[model samples]
Target: MKFFARIVAVLGGALIFFVGLGTAVFKSGLLGLVICLAAGAFVWWVFAQEREEYRGNIEALNRETGLNFKEAFGSGTTSMCIDETARKLALLEQGGAKHRLFGFEEIDDWELRWTEVSRNGSLSFQNVHFTFRTTQLEMPIFKVGVNSKLNGETWSQKLRLLMA
Candidate 1:
């Protein structure tokens, strides 16, 4: 899915660039070319930033837990499941039975951090980070969109209640 999105972005950017170039040559002047260049630059910047973030995330995970996060959470499509009966949270990735389980008893603390970016009085982006305790590593469970903030807060509350 992410790969497909990247492909779409590249193709869309290229299309915009070509259209702008054609317009500049046939009808419009330098204005068309400038708009096209801006569109292409934006696409390239977005992809570059995303790549840097992935690299940083993997490096941090490796430094803290010695786990290769890129291999563990391939394509970042991890399915999260909470078992109330067992008091555990499980992460399933890559259609494999292999998973990482976090018992409520093992958690010492948890926090959900949220950030929002606004541009011209309009919300541009909102993100949430879930950080919690592990036996040996204090790693964040996930960083997701603002829509997941409520769920993350609920999960953290449940874990705290279980601990108490």
Candidate 2:
């Protein structure tokens, strides 16, 4: 999972850091110091860039929709976000340049599908697909792929209750 990947990344960074530190203390001097500094700087830069990009995307989404999204899902322009206070969902497109806003009562139908898939004979993993159908206007059939079925189901249930 994501947590496992983070653990692995941290361990890898630590290993590199310690190796550089050891080399600086026992063998090489300037080269090892440079390695250690680069390793730490690379990690910091990677995390900082990711955080800024995510923040920018969320801010752009909010500006495009005029709704504050506590959590946004999906990627690029094809994102799904809910404004809990407004009881509304915003489907973004064209990199937030265009969007479809729908209230709970306006969503005629929706489905959350779970499927197992594998790549290059690797272990199979579950993918959750969330889809919505409405009669008010013409819209593309966008399938939002969630990380897990539980996440998809939880969102589906929340929408179900809101629409009810």
Top candidate on TM-score is 2
What's the TM-score of each model vs. the native?
0.43, 0.57
lDDT of 1 by residue, 14-121 (tens): 888888888898989697789698778968886896666555644554455444333221223343445555566555443223356566666666567777688889
Over all chains combined, what TM-score does candidate 1 have?
0.43
Q: How many residue pairs clash in each candidate?
A: 0, 0
Question: In candidate 2, what are the lDDT values of residues 14-86, reduced to their tens digit?
Answer: 7788889989999998878987997787667656755565567667878866778655565433667778788
| Candidate-wise lDDT, in order | 0.58, 0.69
TM-score of 2: 0.57
| Model 1 bad stretches (over 4 Å) | 1-76, 95-98, 123-125, 137-146, 158-164
Clashing pairs for predicted structure model 1, backbone only: none
What clash count does candidate 2 reach? 0
Q: List the lowest-lDDT window of 10 residues for candidate 2.
A: 70-79
RMSD of every candidate to native, in Å, equals 10.4, 7.4
